[model samples]
Target: DKKGKYTVLSEKLTSEPMGIGFKKGDKELEESVQKALDDMQKDGTLSKLSIKWFGTDEYKK
Candidate 1:
């Protein structure tokens, strides 16, 4: 049996992509984080995590 429910507030509202904010001039850390995220996406770990946490892989389309 299912127990979850949801409603749409606005059809025009789309899912916005989120980002990690870093301090100014923190290029090295930002680049490293970006590389790690890219690697995770390439290896399917990101999708897996999304589904595990959000019930759906929202990152994929």
Candidate 2:
């Protein structure tokens, strides 16, 4: 096995969208969470956090 160092020699093979899940009939909670996420997105908070963790603003795209 190559252990000291390694490099990727292929292009991206797949992509998946992430999501948030909650109980099936909790419309109030769902709406609240959705609104919160929307607010973050609108205010640039999400982008900032994404850049902080991933080093790129993947969420904004």
Candidate 3:
């Protein structure tokens, strides 16, 4: 995406891989969000949303 409008930040922000952040002890909310993401991935909604926003499925990279 060097030619794209925004510069992609290749560096990891932390030792932990990037992911959704939750409030302390928000296990239930985190699990719910994970399940939603999993469902979207299975249903192609996630890829569709990616394409809609980024013009491609970034995950394919």
Candidate 4:
């Protein structure tokens, strides 16, 4: 289910979410980032970027 060079070998043992960090109360920054992410998902840019960077979008599972 992956296009990367590595093998899965076994089922995923843990979950690790990734994202940007900001100051404790940066609502403006949060809003802007959330908007960009939404726009990308809406336009299919997120899928393309995910494939390019992670080699597969099956991680969406």
TM-scores of the candidates are 0.69, 0.70, 0.64, 0.65
CA-lDDT, candidates in order: 0.81, 0.81, 0.76, 0.77
Report the Cα RMSD per candidate.
Answer: 5.6, 4.8, 6.6, 6.5
* Residue range 1-61, candidate 1, lDDT tens digits: 4456765343335567778999999999999999999999988999999877666776684
- Kindly report which residue pairs in candidate 1 clash with one another: none
Q: Select the stronger candidate by TM-score from 1 and 4.
A: 1
| Model 3 ranges off by over 4 Å | 1-18
What is the per-residue lDDT of model 2 for residues 1-61, given as tens digits with 9 covering 90 to 100? 7786886544444567778899999999999999999999999999999777656686755
Q: Which pairs of residues collide in candidate 3?
A: none
Give the CA lDDT, 0 to 100, for residue 7 in model 3: 68
Give the per-residue lDDT digits (tens) of candidate 4, residues 1-61.
6579786544545568777998989999999999999888888888888777666673363
Query: How many clashes does each candidate structure show, in the order listed?
Result: 0, 0, 0, 0
Quick one: RMSD of model 3?
6.6
Cα error, residue 57 of model 1, in Å, equals: 1.0
